[model samples]
Target: MGGGRSRAALVAKARESIAEGSKSFTVASWLFDKSTRERAHLLYAWCRRCDDIADGQEYGFRDGARDLKLDQASAKDRVEAIRILTHRALDGQPTADLAFDALGLVAAECGITREMCDDVIDGFALDADGWRPRSEGDLMRYCYHVAGAVGVMMAKVMGVPSDATETLDRACDLGLAFQLNNIARDIWDDDAAGRCYIPEEWLVEMDIPPGQLMKPAYREQLVQLAGRLVSIAQVHDMRARVGAGRLKFRQRWAVLSAANIYGAIGKKVHARGEAAWDHRVRIGFLAKMGHIASALKETMRGSYPPQLEPKWTRGQLMAAARMAGPVAGVPNTPLRDEGVRRKED
Candidate 1:
């Protein structure tokens, strides 16, 4: 693959990757301007590739016939491979993999640092270590590493100033909300895979034992917990909306549409309870379109007020981010309110 051809191939591959892997995101991305949409697809390709590599799945679907084992040693090696390739890509070296090259392009265009990439990889490391959350804080920290950090990077890719710490924090909050919804919706599938993300304390309070979450007796308790997760997601989703208001109209519409779509998944999960996992919860195409319409309306109205206190502080979230390393150039400033507010205020 020569220079120009290779770049074109990489971009084509990225578009295919997103279309195959995430229908919701693919649909929402259409709202972005051409340049932003293409770059977002590039970023998504890299992210989807990393996730597939970590889970030993192809586009998130497992080959159940194969004897898939969760060997920590092997997982570590895979993580290392991901890191090496990613670093080479970040260094502007040829990695041969379109996903890595896409990452490099996005990094260069967005000023994304190695530290941000490392933060996302650290989430994979936790999975490799067979980590399970002991408390709400532990779960939220995991969420930050895996999803919130990516949100920050996405915000940067969308041209949010690096110095806009508050807006970035809200972006992180949206990712947190998305992951919480994912955890709630996938509890059964994750347990079947010999993993669980809900806090052990919550399970114990409900009198359920580890690895036995799917037991029929615990359904009610699990529903209550899922509801709690959705409630938290709702709060963060609203705060994220405020942050979205700061972007250009088209970008704002896209962000709000994504938030509504993901938030709808959480709401449906909460509504369905244990039955949510009986069949994977998803927002239908019609429901997604409805959200997109609402997003457009919200963008036009343009009235996002500052939020009340968030459950967690920006300092706490930043500390979690720093667990991987310094967030390159992000200031270590304290957030004014628990929630994100407009910069003008």
Candidate 2:
């Protein structure tokens, strides 16, 4: 968004740093021409900064939980640090700190809801404490707070209709699905970090030891779990496809392309199981090219696929029902994507 330099270059770099190749918005954003790209780059930079902070990455440093550990500071200290840094960044005051300050300005100018930003902080706090949910509902709440809030912020930036809350709703669902995939993928790695997001209840009900599951014996069940989550993800995809169908041609295709790329990870998880440990499941380069091409064709045709309906456990239904009014609607957003993004990016 900084002018006087090439806008395309800035956006290209921002995309590399923030969403890892422009994320789901890439297809639609390409339709915006130069001005929108520049604005979106600044917007993504703001988002990336806040995301890095909440996930506790150090500025200009790739590997460290240093920022997350700061949660150990007194609550007053944490609040003050966030507030001061946020202010400085907003004022463009030169300082060692920039995350919160810069993000505050972006939120103010972009109409990103304050509540959504706070929810991201809240999710980070939960992570810092090494908290794990006892039930599915608790995990869902965490997902909604962390990832679903991103959906709300995105809807604001993209100029979604005020009356089209369902688009926002589907976006939230898409975030949830993304998160759930992350949780499924990170079972081993999270254990290494002394954290676990899978609900304790699921383990207890299945009589699987959390530790043993980390081994090879539970590979089949892990695949089952992976299948179940992928099914759930498909449902979210359906809702998003439906929701995007209501948007402009470019926006709808953008949403569909992203969903397809992210959701396809489930297939890799299904096939390889623990081999997924070696490298993250990713859509192949050829597949990515195909996805882009298909997205363009589909956009022009206004063709979107029908989504698969997910079968939920009674508990999952009950949990979604609590936060989102009913299982009749889509379940609460999934919390698992953060881990995936952390590893893949």
Candidate 3:
């Protein structure tokens, strides 16, 4: 949209990426006005591309995304590639990839920042390094980079000003909530991938040895830990709902619908107890519609609770991320792909 391609063409591709990558988000996006919806799609395209490259997938679930494998060397190189392209996009240099160019368009329009993009990239870097959370705090920090920062960017796309810190915090809360539900939902798949987000301390506390989380004898302990995770998600979900109440009616409707839909997944995981992982947790089309209807009704309900005591805030998380230092050490070189151009469009 902002580089060499026509806006219409760029939009079509971005829309396709979202339509293919995430059903839940694609459905929720419909609640926004045309402009907001398109910008959201554009942002999601870049995020999806980065994730796909890092994981050796296409979009997210299609093209044998699950079956594809990424070794440590490939993972690191891919993460670096994403970082280079993102910086190129942000600097208004040619990135070649349509997704990164889409990021340039929306970022130029909405004041999305370098720090915001960096935060999201840091998550991919962590995954590339095979990093595991050692504490509950570490788990949330990973969530903040992976999802919370995306929430902040989404808030800006929906017209929340850059300085709207409180609203942005709540947006980040929504992202944290989404990631927590993901952690609860994807535990089995994550184990299969040789990645686990469960804090080491929690595993130690439960006497579940490393890599034995899915063993029959440790199932109860796993359930208990997942229950705790969902409980934490509910708090951030509540805070997010409260923040949604401050948005325009349509925006609020969309945000709350997503919140309700994802909150349901986390709740179901808790409700299922031992059988939680028998199948992947998902809401059907009908259930999604039901949540959409419920969200409209929730929009009418009045004031939130006087306090939402989130254990972590976006400010604190940002500070912690700063302390941890840069995600990459080496400078980015030009891509070897034929599509990558030396000249800016």
Candidate 4:
């Protein structure tokens, strides 16, 4: 198989990866047109693959246990492997991993820069090194590196103009909000894994010792902190809606549906208080269907109320991207030879 045949297989694989890796996203993605939906799946495959590799998990399976031991040397080697594979993929070279090839296809089609992918990889690097945030700003910056960067890439995949900085920043805000929700909901799980995303300063403020978050005595204090985290996520989620308004009808509906699904998770966490971690918070299928229906209504209404001004700026986010490395000078060129010989890193 070659040309269209090969491309179709890659896309099918990517779609399968998304379906198995993230059911919620797979459900929300149905709102996208076929082309955008395929590209989104392709991009998500690369992101998911990178995350799985970094955490030592099997691709497409969240049940795999991660090694809690931090081996800095081994972690650095993995990061290097990700960098080499990603660079080759962006250069239109074949890679051993189909997910990386999908990345190349999406990067070529959507003009995704090396800087954007690097920012995401950097997040994995942080996790591999067992980094812990010391302050709220640090946590937010980590979120930007991981999820916000992915959101920016997704915005590009959605066909947002590269120069549309405001819309792009809002896209980043949405990713940050989604991550905040994850952090709030996964506090116990992360703690069990010897990782903590909650800021050390916040823990100190609550008089809770670092790495002792699950102590029964601090349950109420932790619940209060989770509520605050969800509140912040809500603010950014609303701002993200402002950006969604700028997308096409189908894209807008898809983005809004995703927001509602993830935002609902955070709200449920907040409502459940400390009990949020008693069981992993999940949005049921019926609720997700309802969110999609509501999103469709919002799309038809075609107007979102004004959002509060965001504290984070496009410059700040872009500056972080630049810090990852100089922006690749690759032109937004059309896809070249799709039959490039595969390269192993």
Candidate 5:
């Protein structure tokens, strides 16, 4: 098949692969619209494929096959996919890799830098390394590279002005919050695979070994820590909502819908605590549809709330934002245990 034919097949395949037509709330909410739907599918496929390559190496492959397991082929595929869409976008041809193609087109059309994409890929690459993060900040840095960069990319794609610096900053904050939720949600699964992304320092300071968390003895402390993480994530959730007001109508609604859905998950986590391990919490289908309707309502009004205060203090926001790089000079508060355990940067 030619490129056009292949692209069509790819889109159809993606929709079939992602039942309910989305992998997450970010895409799931707006996917009813054709344009956004296709783009969301393609973006999900692209990001999912990249993540799978890095993660696939850990599941019972022979020792010798590890290198091949983590080969650069998936990354190459993403690049080629983007290249085709980028060309079509430049030529003013409607492209097939909708989400990613839109991503490329928007980035190019708006002059958004490509460094953010590179950073996302770099963070995914770190997954191939058999290392546990030593601090919550380290974990956030990883989250920023893999997820926060995507938030920046999406903002640029939406054509948000550089002068809307405050909004852009909050968008970045939302990404980290969402990723932290993922970490809290997937702790059991990640630990089972010998991949503990939770900060080792925090665990140590709690007088807990990550392995022992599996025991019932540490259940209360685990619950408390998990609750705290959820609270921290709420700060970003608020930032995201406030930031959404600064976007154009359509994009503003998109961000709000997404933030609402994901932010709801954090609430579920806090309520359920260790129960998150038993089953991942998801907003009910009705709740999701409701969120979409709410976004549309706000979009039609053309008026987003202005002058909303940030839920987090300036100091807290800075700590979350600096997760993208080495963290130094940041205050460390005491956890359940009294002693301090600072990891070397």
Candidate 6:
């Protein structure tokens, strides 16, 4: 990627990063071909690094994290640093960081563009700004930047054509599905971490006061909201399956398997109802294997057409990401990070 860095060394670090950052992803990645696997791992390393930097965590651990400005202040600085480093990585410049270097490598090999990387970085910028969704559209917009864009990059790593818009949308759908599930499962934890992704309108409708979501009196209402998030996730997951059919067998299998595994978390969270936040929900090993088996069976059958239409399209959300509230009645701009733009009215 840069002058002296060896691809092998970068790949090795990437392997370690994925192993430590996401066990589920590591398991799913093994299903990819060798070249795709390496590239996927490399891309994941950068994404993981940026996430950790944005959240003030190291390797996904958030314990005693306030010292890193987990809430604000330096969080904004951290986001800007991420943007600068990502820009460097996209430019083939040495960033003096393995994760950013890995991004440079993957972007070079896979045709990932500056826009794709910026789309993801936008999510971190939102978090840094202490921004929250005011509506369902806002929530999905956040999900698009954080996870959907990354999914599109992942599809490219799998050798998906740049012109495959629907496939890319499906890929983005999987990311949105995953993020929605995460929000459902981690609603309390995110609150504990001084963050919340649930839309303000939902909270107001439920009459759950800010920062009191976990209070015993409001637990049921919170569960209802969580269920809604999961319901939305399920729809995206279903549509994403259709997109998976467009991939090669192994890629499709890996994607559906991972989808099922993550989907299990949201289902379990919803099934638990009021008790969902009592402990963190996780898919067990046997359950993971079962999902994998189901995916294999699903893979054997020919791909099915989607039975549902998208409630929101990537193009629409991306357009939202590219705008601030209004600049002299001009909505679009080249620099679209959260620091440069506010949520549109």
After superposing candidate 6 on the true structure, give the runs of residues whose Cα lies further than 4 Å from its correct spot. Answer: 65-71, 325-345
193-241 per-residue lDDT for model 6 (tens digits): 7788998889999998988878899988998999999988877888899
**How does each model score on lDDT?**
0.82, 0.56, 0.86, 0.82, 0.58, 0.86
Runs with alpha carbons beyond 4 Å of true place in candidate 3: 62-69, 306-308, 327-345
* Predictions: Cα RMSD each: 4.5, 8.1, 9.3, 9.8, 8.1, 5.7
- TM-scores of all candidate predictions against the true structure: 0.91, 0.72, 0.92, 0.89, 0.69, 0.92
lDDT of 1 by residue, 1-345 (tens): 111236567778999999999999999999999888888998999899999888889888889885555787887788888899899888888887888889998888888899889889978877877777776776777788899999999898899988999899989988998999888888888888888888888899989987778899889988998898887777777788888988988899999999989988898998876678889988899999999999999999974664554576445866755653422223222322234333354
Candidate 3 lDDT over 1-345, as tens digits, reads: 367766777788899999999999999999999999999999999999999888887766536444444688888998889988898888888778999999988999889998899999998998888888877777888899999999999999999997888899999999999999989999998997889999898999999999999998999999999998998888888888888877999999999999989999999999999899999998999999999999988888843652446677788778777777555333222112222122223
Candidate 5 lDDT over 129-157, as tens digits, reads: 44456766556566667676667656665
Point out where model 1 deviates above 4 Å: 1-6, 321-345
Per-residue lDDT of 68-128 in model 2, one digit per residue for the tens?
2344445334434544455454454533533233344445556565445555555655665
- For candidate 2, give the lDDT: 0.56
RMSD of 1: 4.5
For model 3, state the Cα shift of residue 116 in Å.
Answer: 0.4
What's the number of clashes in each of the models?
A: 0, 9, 0, 0, 2, 0
Residue 74 error for model 2, in Å? Answer: 8.4
TM-score of 5: 0.69
- Return the TM-score for candidate 2, rounded to 2 decimals: 0.72
| Pairs that clash in candidate 4 | none
